[model samples]
Target chain A: MTYTEQLNAFYKMVSDECVQGVSLDCVIFGFHDTRLKVLLLRWKGTHEWCLPGGFIYKTESVDVAAERVLRERTGLDQLFLQQFHLFGDAVRYNREDTWQRQKMPMPFESRGWPERTLSIGYYAVVDQTKVMPTADFMTDECRWWEVSDLPSLLYDHRHIVEVALQTLRLQLSWQPIGLNLMPEKFTIPELQRLYEAVLGRSLDARNFHKKIMGLHILTRLDERRTGKAHKSPYLYQFDRENYKKALISGNLSFV
Target chain B: MTYTEQLNAFYKMVSDECVQGVSLDCVIFGFHDTRLKVLLLRWKGTHEWCLPGGFIYKTESVDVAAERVLRERTGLDQLFLQQFHLFGDAVRYNREDTWQRQKMPMPFESRGWPERTLSIGYYAVVDQTKVMPTADFMTDECRWWEVSDLPSLLYDHRHIVEVALQTLRLQLSWQPIGLNLMPEKFTIPELQRLYEAVLGRSLDARNFHKKIMGLHILTRLDERRTGKAHKSPYLYQFDRENYKKALISGNLSFV
Candidate 1:
């Protein structure tokens, strides 16, 4: 579509029905190759990247809006999505120079949106291999970037990512929610590596192993046979029933 | 002041300069006599009690607005305040019969307020003895109510209080922030009771004592003396330096 057509389509989509002054930005987290990553989108006609976000419709609840945004971006449904924080800094969208630097029109301002906006930040854990991200009409590209080495994001997105990571790290301490980012079966070393990536530091392997075993949320599985490896560690799968019980009772502690 | 004069004053206070479609409801928590309580206000011309709340001004950040509201109601400043949740149900303010039943004017609608509003829930911990809650123009009275036995609240204030308590319970598992609700010198049993009040369940005394001792975030003080009591338990004060460090590093675990 032409630039005008895309802009007009975007305007038409949002102008009539969305709740004014409110938006939902999602930090979809995925674990792959021993690194934690977040999904970002590059706006059309600009190199500026931002979290996949959209305004809430007047007829829908905020939670439903978040789910809709996630489904539209990842083509996945019923994932563990959590509302973590709300960013309401008055200057969150005041960087007009950013638009000028990127050589893109200020769609929100030009189209007469609310002067001040409050965005609800949500974080989701999904299996990276299961997602096939497709750009929407207003986005030129959609891709995953390592959370540790993210680009210069638009607006307060960098801060949003930091808060999301902090929330994820806190949640990791008490709940076994990170299993959504892992495969159906995984080795102890792989699980430890994912925890290390999310916590942004290396943990003592022996202590981590002892803690995980004490929690008793993971079931031991048959050893994986990587032919080239000297010896394969035992694989494990998260015991779904026990995990849910632990989450509800606040018993799972891995930190 | 007369009812009409108070109502007019409240209308003038909120009509001209507040942000549209956004409000802040504060769940100010206090602990006294081994019970957790929340500050609530009876609205003018209505027996319905609600969390002491106000609107955010266009010129101030939401955080500042929360502090302002708390200070206005309690005459306390620099307390431990946290933004826990945003209540944004489409029907949050759709209960007109609630107003009509109380014979109170629908000031918000009569003054041309937005049809829908999103409220940010903030929880503040303060020493109950230090607070001197004064009624504002819109409030007929302001008082603290035990969380265990609260009266019918306005809007979704009940849900807001529940979320605040849940957040407090979650924070108790990781941080020593509940100290604000405790006296300067407290026994281990007193501390345990505070935790139980926040968690809404009785905890094992020996286990809780051992866990708290292992944390080493409390400085043992001299034993308290009571003429009619049995053996006195040792008193303790939170070691401020270590408490701050634990909060920053996320190491303080009490559960």
Candidate 2:
């Protein structure tokens, strides 16, 4: 089907089976090459990029809807998704110029939709090696962009991304990071790099190592990383039982 | 106006000026008499109680709408309100028995509202002494109920309260509690009781005092509480500068 045909079918589905005026945006975080990356989509007929988002169906809860969107885009399920904030600014969806730039019909105005729409923002951390990024009918590209160097996002999505990162950084003080992003057996420096990426700053290596060790959630392996040039560092992996206990207690501190 | 007339006017106002299917609920919390309390409203002409909530106007943001609701209900402003979660279950508002129990009209069915309504949940901490609780047209009584001994709430409101309290307790690890709940000058035991109230558990007195002092957000006041038969304890006030810094950095760990 053509772009216009696909959009028609999408809008028809939205009208027939989805709840109006309620949507959700996902700021998917993945750690790759010592940098935090976010998943974004480029509109099918335009260069404009936005966070992967979708409308809530009338039958499913908002969380279920978010999980479905994640599964559709990443080909993965139950990937540590959390609701962070609700973006309900009056003019969040009032972007006519975006449509004109894409040369596509305005979805809301044509359908006599509500003047104000609200979006629930959710952030997910996923394993980059396991993801098969797929674009839906409305977008031509689905890929990861480094958080530090992102394109001009559509609507208030940039603000959404900023808040998601802020929430993630604050969450670091209470929850362990890189459980999904780290390899099963990795060096301490690898995990530290993931924390630095999310925090957008470097940390003193000795201090970070001490703090993480004191948390008692990691299990140091007998072997080293093996491929390093000089003094190879010991490998560590999350002790699943301790990690689960810390998650439920929410007492892991890493500042 | 009569109750039926008030209902008609509220529905008309919602249709004319508010965004349909999007609302907000505020879990107003106050610390009093060594207990954590939540502000709830008793529905007019019914025994049912629920969290104080209101609709969002098309011209306002959700936060602003929440503030408006708080101000209208408490007759006060500038409370420490934080958005914790969004409740968007498909059947969250589908309780037909509630209206049947009230022997009143089902407003949504009468007005053809959306099948799924999403509510943004915000929890606020306020000084109980300063509030002048007031009821709106739909409610006849506004009062605080001890969190441990709350009445059966309407719809899914009991679940909302549970989630709000859980979020508040989790946040206690990263943020200082009792900034709004405590008096200007308080003893360490007084503040510790406030923390216990929110966490629903006890902390060792020496451990809590040591941990709170280590955060460096309080100033040891020379003044002591008078009019006590026992040895009076010294009072301490939160140092605003340090509290502000800790809040921004989010590194204050109490657990």
Candidate 3:
């Protein structure tokens, strides 16, 4: 199909089934190489990046709509997706002219976008290696950027990202959901590094280890065998059953 | 003005200023006499009760709308309000006939409520004694109901209340926001009763006391002087400065 044909088809699809005044923007966080990252997308002809987002369908629950949007963008399913906040500022989309400046099709006004919108904010933690980020017809690139070093984002997404990070930090202090970012087996230092990245501070090694071990939710695995290391740290795996039980029993502090 | 005149004025005001597709429902929770209660309103001429709620104005944020609705219902400002969930099921208001059966005015349909609505759920903790619970033209009565014994509610309000309770329970495990429901000075047993009411389970007195005191957020006060009591239990006040500090430091576990 021609480029204009594709744009018309996209607009038609959105206008046909999408709910009038609601959208979902996802902050998909991943831990890789001891750094916390978030998935972002660049519109086909724009340098500005944005959180992967889409409109909610008329017949779909907001939760289902969020999950569908995330899966379509990341090609990963069943991640820990949570709704944290809703952004409904009156001027949330006042910068539609930016798309026109970028020489891209304007999806908002062209398709009779609702005069006002309430965008539901969802955050997900995923294993970075498992996701193969895909770019759609409207996206030129899709990639993960370190959370601490994000580029200027479109719309009010920068505020959304900041809030998502705050929510994740608050949630991490009480729940063990951060384990979703780790591989099947990881070293103690690796786990600590992930915490440090999320908390944006270096923790005392001894105190961190003591606190994590006291939770009784990790099973020690075989020692790492890196030849160049001074002394390889021991690897550990989350005891899924105990972790589930701890979550149910509550009061499992991680910070 | 006559009743019909008042109804028409209310509807006209709502339609004039409110956004078309979004609404805010507040689950105002209060603790009194060792029981957890929720503020509910009875639609005019109907027995059904519902969370005190209102639609967002075209120029207002959802958060502001929630706070406005809450303050209007409770006659209090700046309570511990937080957004918890969004209800967007396709059939959220499918039972419109419930209004017809009661011969009640349909504020939603009469005002051209959107084909689909996405109601944002906010939960607030307020001092029960401070609320006057005023009824509007559309409401015949407004009162508090025990969380465990709520009457039949309108639309999807029953589900909204259940989710609010769950959110409150989860939040109480990590934050000290529940102090909003208590008097300025309270006894240890009184605070424990609030926890018990929220959790719906009796906690061991010794364990509950030890855990609460360990947080170091309360200041001991002069003993209560109840004339008929076997013993006067000492009153305690939350150290407002330390409580604020603890909230900022971010690990004030209460449950």
Candidate 4:
């Protein structure tokens, strides 16, 4: 009938004929209060925790499947999710604890799910404060764990997490999506702390300040860190228009 | 029969139990004589060039699928293969003009027989000199095309090639896989040209030289480019140990 209806029909047709063979694993990275975190779920059969994950229909693109998983798991709409790595070790599905062997209703699914399931790991740096975490579909619970305290995980998931962190570390050098991880307005120390957490190393306070101030990505806000500090650091908010322009041309370098 | 034979017997018992739906498409990259090149396959149906691809059996891992694809197509036994992107768009299969829809037995498998198929794209940065370019199984012919002048391709292969280029461009900063694309010993100008080709822009020769030399990944050889009229640039080879160390642990700033 209309353009929307035609578009819907196209989507329906695609899913029917495409023979989809894909799924999403979200390396949901979040920074809450001060510590950097990743969203993980205690898997169904075991005590091991893993980043939220699910299978993509035989008809969806890996990117769209990833986004769907992120939104479905976190209850965050349109969170900035990035597909970072694909875990394709042949024995990745050998474990008796994997969700794949759980008799999914989709008959042609993981039935003979390859001995190694190829999982496309997607990273989403979400605003922990803004988004409500909901674990409805297949997770026992979805909560942010300090990156440092990540427990034993299943399969090559540990490696996947490591890769996602590596990608995040690289992204931090050029793209300052850290603002999304923090509040609308954050202090200098908060910004520095987030960077240190992501980088997993200490930065020279003065140098970090100089770098941030030089980029001018942040505008000074009329507030301070408010708690116990020798000097209350000035609050800063991101300059969205400038950031978007820098991002679009792919010039979001902070280093 | 022994337990080993029992395990083998069991494996055969369930070999058909797996559900296979995934595939790997390699956007093999190379730098030949200073021009950025990509390894492409010319299918029999049309002259359209496409990445060498293969399906992951219900029993194999993604990496195995890629390696098998390489072995099946180029006769490359081993090379530096990496999975960079996964193209799972539902409509990626049904594109008109150049897809091999007739030879394939099924949309997914039906290999050897002429057919239509949807494939995932993995990228490999290989020593092109090592690839035998031997035809195997379903492929007609394989050729290395200059990345800048890639021919009309099938499906989402163009996007896959672009993604591989992006991966290489980003990886060039941390890892000196640039060496993999070059001859054993290359002059400074040769190396510079390689970077310029992949980056698709002219870098200041002096500054580029300074930065590359400073990375300490190159070992100057005891020879020079003889044909040049100007000062013969000394030959250099990448110091793999240092490059590997840097790649594994260091933070990269190059955008």
Q: What is the C-alpha lDDT of each candidate?
A: 0.83, 0.86, 0.83, 0.69
lDDT at position A5, candidate 3 = 81
Could you give candidate 2's per-residue lDDT for residues A1-255 as a string of tens digits?
877777777887887788777789999999889999999999877888999999888878999999999999999896789999998887775477766655676565576566667899999998887899999878889999999999978878899999999999878866886787776788889888899999888999999989888878899989897765889999898998988888888767666
DockQ of 2: 0.64
**Candidate 1: CAPRI quality band:** acceptable
- The candidate that achieves the highest lDDT relative to the unseen native structure: 2
Q: Which stretches of candidate 3 lie over 4 Å from their true place?
A: A1-12, A92-111, A203-243, B1-16, B93-111, B184-189, B201-239
Model 3 deviation from native, Cα RMSD in Å: 3.7
Ranking by TM-score: 2, 1, 3, 4
Q: Rank the candidates by lDDT, best first.
A: 2, 3, 1, 4
Residue B147 lDDT in model 2? 94
Q: Could you give candidate 3's per-residue lDDT for residues A1-255 as a string of tens digits?
A: 966688888778877778766779999999998899999998777788889999887778888888998999999888789999888787776566656644565455667765677789999999898899988887799999999999968778899999999999887877777568988888888889989999999999999889889888899976774765488777789998888887777676666
True contacts kept of 4: 0.68
Error of 4 at B142 (Å): 1.9
Q: Once all C-alphas are superposed, what RMSD does model 1 give against the true structure? A: 3.4
True-vs-predicted CA distance for residue B28, candidate 4, Å: 1.9
Clashing pairs in 3: none
Question: Which residue segments of model 2 deviate by more than 4 Å?
Answer: A183-188, A203-239, B184-189, B202-225, B231-242
Q: Please name the candidate that would achieve the greatest TM-score relative to the true structure.
A: 2
**Residue-wise lDDT of candidate 2 within B124-237, one digit each (tens)?**
998888898999888889999999999868878899999999889878866896788887889999999999999888999999988999888899999999898989999999
Query: How many backbone clashes are present in model 1?
Result: 0
